[model samples]
Target: MSSVQPYVPNKDFIYRAADALADSHLQQALAKAGRGFVDKRSAAVTRVPNFEAMRDRARAVRQKALQDLDIYLLHFEKKVTEAGGQVHWAETPAQMREIVLQLCARHSATRVTKGKSMVGEEVYLNEALEKAGITPFETDLGEYILQLAKEPPSHIVAPALHKTRAQIQDLFLHHHALGERDLSAVEAIVDEARQVIRDRFLRADIGITGANLLIAETGTVAIATNEGNGDLTATLPRAHIVTTTIDRVVPTWEDASAILRVLARSATGQQTTTYTSFFTGARGDTDKDGPEAFHVVLLDNRRSQLLGSEYQEMLHCIRCGACMNHCPVYQAVGGHTYDSVYPGPMGAVLTPLLRHRDGDYQLPNASTFCGRCESVCPVKIPLPDLMRKLRNREQQEARFKGAGYWITKVFCALAASPRLYRALTSIGTKLAAALGARRGRFSKLPLLGGWTAHRDFPAPQGGSFQSQWRRNGKAQPPVGACPAGD
Candidate 1:
């Protein structure tokens, strides 16, 4: 239904990653934002005595919701209808775009204001609206900056985290028509954005936002934000449209509370986001002020198919961005390199499953399997395991081949035979140590040029573990008893 060109994924993620590594501006932005998030989250967690227990509770809530997803969804729809709101089910991105366009058409909306909605980006809703002769204004400061720059979000919670303050000032100066004024401070930038967005909000015919959690019991769409833009976006316009996925539904407000307990702490390290607003359908006769018409567009987009699949655990994601915040790979390459709306660890698993296209298969292979993503996840989604499963699925489907495949096969074969493994490892370690003993590190290696390309690889010290164990009077286990290890 969208007249715009179909979204083309950037297949050159490796190349993009290389470019990101070379980008000084991106590197600085990443370093600054990454440390801030890590420190804040660490401090926030320390304040809560039972943060781990809260994570367990959040995981249980999500798991229970997913187990009976259909029931909760039905109940959600029933409550929305009871509140005089309409619920539209969209099985795919195309269907979602069409549904939203129809809703806009019903209201004859020309100017739409939006709060930060990743689902909107997932479906390319802004482009669709543009094609339909509708103008959508992004109210969130980060999202607004990206909109002006015509770029995708670089971070989930902080969508424009990749941009520097100087870059933002330039963007605002170029896009905003309000005669150049002093824009040297952070307050200046926020004030300017506020002034510009306030006018747009007042003139908007429709407001669109994403839901953090949907409570089936009361058909309440809960949104958490620091800017209060979501509240304005949901309340100001004549019509309010909630664009979100089906996986966001929970059985009750109490379940929503459990997830919220972890969401803010994991995201911005605040005990709670500044503004937490709830919307239930349209404004009633007794209501003082609210949208006249309310609609919720629930997008499946392969999520229903993923319910019983190996990737079902991924649905537990609360979009806290903590996994990505702590991911070393994400820090190095930045979100844009992933070339998907969803980036970082969560994106590595999600983009491939949701998109399922060529080049996307490389995402799962982008990790070092350091397991920090899983450690920081609020819901404790096994990100590393899911990525491994994706990699396995790729290999099973023969999506990976050539040198990489043969190398893995050779390693597996060698690893299967303990005698061969120990012999090769001993010889390899001794050879590496001998070769790099002068420098204590290898600046270059025959088959591992890529590893040494960025930094020196530490030379192995002394004999292999098995050899040292034998030298220390430890009895050697049977050949197959010890798994392959260095």
Candidate 2:
């Protein structure tokens, strides 16, 4: 019942992306955040012997779980009930929010501490909590930073990834009462937030966390976090609730371990998270720790419909941010531009399927087709391929009369005949060459202002491939490397 309605702004990707590209502070933040993740992942996998093999195993585990997802989910539910915990099925975000509110009301919970939950973000759970008169404190540092800023998470793992250190300093100064504390260092900033949230953790009436893996064999919920707050939040409170989607479940402990191995390597480039904790139901009669009541609310939200579809592989995703980290478009503009609870390549594929009315068809065409997303995927979800499929779906459905539809239609017409394509491309190249003769690059152009407005687009130099091939008598370039433009 605690799932929040979508707080994510569903804006046109083109307009928002233009705004993001023009934002200097956001640009700095993206540059700073993007490289660290890429380098760390490279290093982490380099350290592991045959990391590819581990990824293969993880992919197999996920595929197997998805194949029999219903069976595993039922097994998981049975185990939870046997361990004295209840399972609630939420078909929609509203149902999820209602279920959580009822649990909070049952316990008369006024304050709740929460670990990072992407599912919560999907539902805008924090907003719902405030609406319900329950104060929820975010214990994770990244989530806490974003909460203070009153911003939705830009990136999944690093929710505040689009915030520079200076911006964070400003946020803290505005939010906290620090007379003369030296807050120059990143560590100091984190410590200050830790000190602030510590009391909330101890005093909260209930705790809610998202599960990284749900094991059917033991009906155990596992969470992996850099901060130890998840363990504290779950065990310290009188009531514990796990809010997550059904796709998170796996068949057994071993399968969970296999996913974890790649999950760490893919996410943050660590061999393991700083704290990986597991919980089964509530505290036992002889046990002195854990909440008296434990509940798991699993949201379907049409994910079950994707079970046998082309996108079933998407459910295999481990929520690792690797795909976005390696994405050039995301690196350039950052997450908020996508205007989705999920962003980047994964979001480009999933968001449209989940909420088709979000004007997200343009998302599929957001790729350069580098395929880094598929290459780096822990569970190997073919992100680019899925996006391509969505693109085809959009074309078939004739969803919109936007620029993409017309452009794609023109391209398709041209692609049907080599002669027409060659003739048109030759004329187009020569025309572009003549137009840019003064500068050798275009600062702006019709239908291409998205790229040209921010940066220069190098005009065609040598000639179209057809002309060059005909002139050179083969696939070799035309004699001159550069055209007369410059």
Candidate 3:
């Protein structure tokens, strides 16, 4: 038997998070981009009367599809073969990369045009192509920006959401041969990128894209985009290759529609993206113009294992990125802080499970269990519950230990005993109140440098809730009433 190597997380998450916090450019970019998504989504949902019902239907479709994943995949394969296209299953990233390379090599592909695909990012497909001496051109505007800057995407839907206009101007000036053209306006930047990529689109032999949903009923791949880059990438090249995960499949076009109804609304606050293209197979004999060859590379990458597990619901994710857009942690530190291809709340749970590596354990702990991710998810994935499951598994596997664990243990033990808990709380509260009576808050405190270093800790004013309740002789509301606790 071959030995499997353990996964090791990127060690730069903490340092990068701190740097992002201090970076004025990144902060400004994030601030400008954050509220736009939130507001647009809010307006979109308000415009739809049955938005919640649509979400429920989307969730149900995903659940049903995952329940019979193998059956649907086989059906999809049969349909694809019947339609004169090919289906390739890859159990790992390495296998997927190799498969794509072989296909490109067979076609003598030199230059490849690419649409935005997170799965490609997962397998580092661009690097693989470059290593094999093939050049890959990013067609998506945001992707092109990141490609020129040599940075991984900060957000899934909006890859360059972390970059400001000033930064983009500098990148374009440094990379493009613009003869003193004024690049200050956003329109100029768009035009510059469009002109550059249009040539690549026409010249490329192969085009690679990710599917929003794979329809098993018709062997069709559906993609949604605002810029129509995916359409150009699919139709312009001699061969079109789809690199996507198994979880993206749906049983039928109806299922795809159910999900699509909420996808754009959740993703960018639009009722639908400007371009929603569907391609089934290679160009038909009567077709005016399309790819000569069609290939689908479906990657498992541990998602198959995820189907039957407690984390199965995560497969329902439509990649709309509503969770991340609303996530406080993602908004504060940005996507690069997570040190994974997927970032924010979804990444926190999904990355560790998919990677199952050493440092991934830290990801689950990254959340405050705020549950905003679950609240905003278009497919209703219980992100907080899944993260908690990972944390519990870590505890059971003894993946974490030390003063923190012991402190939690001691607190739990004390919490179970009312007398001891009261005694400790009373003493601590009195001490803190007395020390900060004049200042009203503590700027520094021993054994709490983590909290005090960034912000002041407000001094305890009143006694414990139980103590206050006893003195007032008032009945307290149930815990559920106070969902947002201090």
lDDT of 1 by residue, 1-486 (tens): 112233243568888898898989889888778689999999999999999999999999999999999899999999999998999999999999999999999999999999999999999999999999999999999999988878899889999998899888888888778885989899999999998899999999999999999999999899999998999999999999999999999999899999999999999999999998889999999999999999999999998888999889999999999999999999998899998889999999999999987888889999999999999999999999999999888887874476877888999999999999999999988998899899999888888988889899998889988788878636654566667893
Assess the local accuracy of residue 461 in candidate 1 as a C-alpha lDDT between 0 and 100: 85
For model 2, the stretches where C-alpha displacement exceeds 4 angstroms are: 1-10, 422-464, 467-486
TM-score between model 2 and native: 0.90
Worst 10 residues of 2 by lDDT: 1-10
Candidate 2, residue 108: how far the Cα is off, in Å = 1.2
**Model 3, residue 109: C-alpha shift (Å):** 0.7
Global lDDT for candidate 2? 0.89
Could you tell me which residue pairs clash in candidate 3? none
| TM-score, cand. 3 vs. native | 0.93
Task: List the candidate 1 regions with Cα displacement exceeding 4 Å.
Answer: 1-10, 426-442, 454-463, 473-486
Question: Which model is ahead, 1 or 2, in terms of TM-score?
Answer: 1
- Superposition-based RMSD of candidate 3 using all C-alpha atoms, in angstroms: 5.2
lDDT of 3 by residue, 109-219 (tens): 999999999999999999999999999999999999888877889889999999999888888887887678889999999999999888999999999999999999999
TM-score of 1: 0.93
